[model samples]
Target: MSDAILSPDQTARALPYSALAQEIATLLQDPTVAVPPRIVQALQGGGSLFVMPAADAQVAITKLISFIPGNAERGLPTIQGDIVVFDVQTGQRVALLDGPTVTARRTAAVSLLAAQQLAPRRDGPMLIVGAGVQGRSHLEAFHQGLGVQEVWVASRSRASADALVAHAHSMGLQARRVDEPNAALADCPLVVSTTPAQQVVLTARPRSDAFVAAVGAFTPRMVEWSAEVCQHLARTGTLVVDTRDADHEAGDLLQAGLDVSTLPSLADVVGQTVAWQNAHRPADGPVFFKSCGWGGWDLAAARCLERTRAQQG
Candidate 1:
């Protein structure tokens, strides 16, 4: 029999941001789960394909996705593919999920998880950069996970920025379009940078309480923050990464010449209680959360899907 397939909407409905972030938090502490390095192949014209696989005792999953930065210009989804989930013991295919949706949601959930533990203050306006799929996902994740009430949208395309702003307003939050994202950094305590990393979009130094999550540039060649901005954060604030893989893949940190090996990762913080996290923060500077792609995060999505399926049945 063919494996079941879930459309993007169905898959999204299965993995709510709060639940997804909680799942990721759980997996971070589960040493039994195994996540090997993903294989990335370069495609022509600057695009790339990713093959990621992860497994626990009960379920296994492999995701095949391609990212083409030029798709935005052509009015196409930049990310495309599917994730195949399987039963570990039976070796039978369980289901397939829309890869782009999973990627966007899980990546944002990782940022949400970061914000929950790292943000000095939670209730405030948020700033979103890169008005694309990631931008939309981050907006929803923050709204759902952080109770954000207001937002600022910044992007290279005015139309795209305006559309995201409208979407935010539809969600009943105060929203605006900012041509320069850095200018609004002082007031927005939370910021998510989702640009394609072709160039630096945020240059100005953020306020002391800012919690900035930069998920745009996974490869070393791509970058969204200027060197000075990264250095300032590294010197004065706590620098955390989603995973240790960021030691090599985080363009902003690597380009800024910070030692990724010494940085604290999300896993490091996930083990602590929420109150402990809030109380133990550095309290000196902004918190910079660098997220490079990781297969373990995909595993968390699969686990959530499996749980959702079990609950429905």
Candidate 2:
């Protein structure tokens, strides 16, 4: 067997964001499907490297994502890498995807799917709490998936927030920059947090019926929501997680003094227990979705991209 390779340019021509989001949503509906597990290797410079390999019936894909916290000062991206798709049965290489773009699209799509399931069906203002790649991607996803009327960008750096607002407006979105996170929360019922802060930052909890998606913290030491917020989510709304074990190991719930046993898995939500649990229960607070960015989602998205390429060819 030989190694097969497809470059970033080829991936762009093959898989666009619109198609990727639809395929990802379809893949998430099936619980019988399998997702690849992630393997982490520690680097010498206090950074970590990840190799995620996954496949379904049609094709398999492997992604390599590297994280170096100190790269920002050097004008480099903190998260960088590439994705390779392959023929699952023959082990032939199919395509190579831009990791950052793929990650951004898939992450936002996952959140959008969760929102569709949990949030009320209405078009209104939305808030994004980070101004980096993930933050920008969330804006695109919300536009594509939810058709939001207005967008509010909020970041620690005022300039960054203003820049994102400018970008959004250029894309024909009604957007503005907000200096305070609470202001953003107050204005929008839907909020997405994409920061890498070590402690809670959002000043106030989201509205009682609001939906908040937190995808920034992948480690135990990093958290974007406060303990009070997590407690509110656990008590009132449906908290959906990608993996129960993973969330138990590294989520705001654990840090907020809540037992892992108390939370529900995304599987539960897909199975329709979340709604029942919510209806039969008391008012706890806001609904929350915490995603650590699963490799299975990458595999699913990569597989969809591969299929699109094949059909186009």
Candidate 3:
């Protein structure tokens, strides 16, 4: 038995960010479901190929994303790909989602979900590092999910940062560009790093009651946050990750000399562990949400979109 197939255009018409966020939240609460695992292929030119397959209680989805670092020089997208959804019971093809847009939205939504579960309050300024697609997506997600009051956008390229701020302002957001990385970190209670830099970009440490979401640098060799940030997180006891697997990909933690076994997983937090509950507050020094990009999340988003589209018909 096979399922129906949906093209990227169909997914766009079906699944939007608002609905996707809600569905992701619902799926996180239920632990009985199994999300498909991801297979990564590393290339010689600092690029990676990722294949993620996931099945919900009813349907299944797979997303294939390729990140080629060199694409930026060519004025092309670094991350490009597509997603395929299927019916689990029938083994039928269901839909195809726009990989770039879906990836950007789903990744940010997942981070926002973590913040909702782990962060203390929603009304505050957010600092976003990196001015790429993920950075823009994070801004939109935080605005929609958290109803943030103010947002600070920063990147190594001043022009890129300025452009991001302009885009945010056009969207009716209170946004500003900052040349100083630490200044941006200091201004916001929540900080999201979306850059693909090889080293840590944030210079200053976060406040005790701050939340940090590091969504960049999926490869073991790449790093966005610093060792000091990880060390500070350890000292403050406010570090949380989307998955244990992320630590293996995050250079900051691996280079920080901290035991990977000590990091808490997002699943444990969603499952309501005592350690997570006790230490997962904004009052803590800095709560770090590190994401390695999960395919299950993409499937969840795709499934929600599919249901909505079906209902409309």
Candidate 4:
């Protein structure tokens, strides 16, 4: 039987981010999962459409998301789409899932998972760059996953940033808006960048022992971390990627001219912890996880949401 279309609200309510994060970590370690590079089409006026697919022995999923930079001005989200899932054994359609919600929650949880592995501990204010959907979702993720006591929202738009802070306060978290991201970075032990800026937005060097997750600027044309920041990561920190294909999709890595082949994957960390650690760590520096996102995560999250909804009934 086909499931009803799941709205963003419903999806959010059903998503168990912490548990899902563990599942994602397990999936990452699983050699059987296959997630190819997303097929992107250049739309007119600098817009783009992405078709991402993932599958395994039990299930298959494909998500179609569109990016329209001007949507924010019109009071709309830039990332919008849906994920379609099918049963691998029967080849039957099973569900239609809210794409942005799934993408936002899973992306944040994945980042948090990586942070848990690398970060010494979560005990300070988190600096969230870009107060958009990803930013808000990540705030929730860090709050729930790490018990983050304080959060600082930094955005290009003062209004958006302030609004995010207000939302955080409503959730009983200590939150505020900061116009200067670099200054905010100085004090925060955990930092997440979720903007889609074409130019490097974060120029400040993070703390020596900080944990930074850069989740925006997926395309090679866009960048969140400055060249110097990337250089510092390459030199003094362990640079972890969601996938080695990030060598191609991650703008920060590509722009920095770093050798992706040499970078360690999250899978490596999951499977070979000691070796990965020995190879990637600098004597002293911030650990960085650059995620371009992948379809495998989409499929894993979809399964969890679908199961939760089924049990609810």
Quick one: best lDDT, which candidate? 1
| C-alpha TM-scores of all predictions | 0.96, 0.88, 0.90, 0.95
Residue 2, model 4: Cα distance from true site in angstroms: 5.2
Instruction: List, residue by residue over 209-285, the lDDT tens digit for candidate 2.
Output: 68788888876677788888788766766676766545545557678887655556555665667543654234545
Off by over 4 Å in 3: 1-13, 274-283
**lDDT sort, best first:** 1, 4, 3, 2
Ranking by TM-score: 1, 4, 3, 2
For candidate 1, write residues 1-313 as lDDT tens digits: 2367999999999999999999999999998899888888999999999999999988899999999999988989889999999889889998999999999999999999999988997887899989999999999999999999899999999999999999999999999999988899988889999999998888999889999999999998899999999998877887888887888889998999988877778988887645335533565789989999798898899899888777888
Q: Pick the candidate with the highest TM-score.
A: 1
Q: lDDT tens digits, residues 1-313, model 3?
A: 2244555556555656667767876776665557655788988987889988777677777788898988977899998888887777777776667798788888888888888877765666888889988998888888877887688888888888998899889889888887787866666788888887677777578866777888886667778777886787777756776766675766667777776656677777777876566653444456777787777678778667766867877
- After the best TM-score superposition of candidate 1, give how far the Cα of residue 99 lies from its true spot, in angstroms: 0.2
Overall lDDT per candidate, in order of appearance: 0.90, 0.74, 0.76, 0.85
The 10 consecutive residues of candidate 1 with the worst lDDT sum are: 273-282
C-alpha lDDT of residue 80 in model 1: 98
Better of 1 and 4 by TM-score: 1
The C-alpha local distance difference test score for the whole of candidate 2 amounts to 0.74
Candidate 4: give the clashing pairs: none
